[model samples]
Target: MISAISGSVAQSFRPPAISLAARGTESVQPKGSDSGKSSRLGALTEEQKKQVEQLKKTDREVRAHEQAHKNAGGQFTGSASFGYTVGPDGRRYAVSGEVPIDVAPVEGDPAATVSKMTIVASAALAPAKPSGQDRKVAALATSIRTEAQAELAAKSRDKLSGKDESDSKSSALSAQAAYTTGSSPEKGSQIAGSLLDLFS
Candidate 1:
């Protein structure tokens, strides 16, 4: 028996940071911290400029990653939410983001469950660089798909067996009728041949 589908939360690309400044600068004030406080009014130092660019790149990647999930997931996913970090240029950038997706299996319909799980797994892996949490969700989806496929196979086997049993009963009735009617040897042989054909 397959286990119940695990609940999947939003998958984030990275952890949020307070700032993108260098390690030692967190507590120390910059040379002109007061005057150059606003990013629009001051020329950024070389380090600050580099940090800003890095933040911008990170922001773009995070948004794009979440967007991929949203696009593939469609109605099953919620809007992308971001975790922000203040850059050295006094601007907020997205350091991490997540898109929540529905991962529950379809009830009572293994075929539908398989279809839904396929989509869920695709959505989980939609991003170019899938996070660990994303991979976990995809794995869960695969498990669900496997279980549903087994169920569908079982149903097909049950249907075929029931049909075979009905055919066997009909063939037995025909043979019994031939015997009760005191049919000719040729007719009895023909009925036996038919029964053999049915079984074969």
Candidate 2:
């Protein structure tokens, strides 16, 4: 009673591209060019621009590290994928599945073992969540799309010309980080800073 795809389930656990940005690093900017440009940073004051540029340099370093990881053939476990497989009956097959977690026992809780077993069993038995990876992806996609839409909306709302959409979007993004992330004020500020540069 085994299905054709059942054999390849192991391959389905391969990593995926969950990163908001693409792989690779800039091949050294022309003497004075802006590599990996950001419109939001472009709008900042001179002092702020210096800070943003420093951050950009730091981000470029991070991306280089990530690219090294990508080159080594690592993938994001969170992404869903299918893989090719071979069954005991000597047939090639394809199967789709998620990254399986090996739930170990917790020190103080006897129920932890039962809870892990129940989670694994339930994942096998229950229907998949509707939103799926699409929603997780939407976070990045919407960050751009929603930013564009909000930028237009800001033009209409402000009337006067001092502020731009990127500014408003950055502020709103900060508020979202504050509300959803629920980090301490300092950590929240740091997350907001990273999000602004990465998303904008």
Please, what is the whole-model Cα lDDT of each candidate in the order they appear? 0.73, 0.38
Please give each candidate's TM-score.
Answer: 0.74, 0.23
Model 2 TM: 0.23
Best by lDDT: 1
Q: Which ten residues in a row have the lowest lDDT in candidate 2?
A: 1-10
lDDT of 2 by residue, 1-200 (tens): 00111112422222343222222223222334353234434555788666545545544443343233223212221222223232222222233223322223334443443443344333322322312432233233334344445555676577654567677888888878777877557776798899999987
Model 1, range 110-155, lDDT digits (tens) per residue? 9998998898889989999988778888898899899999999999
Poorly placed runs, candidate 1 (over 4 Å): 1-41, 180-200
lDDT agreement of model 1 with the native: 0.73
Q: Identify the candidate with maximal TM-score.
A: 1
Model 2 regions lying over 4 Å from their true place = 1-82, 97-132, 158-200
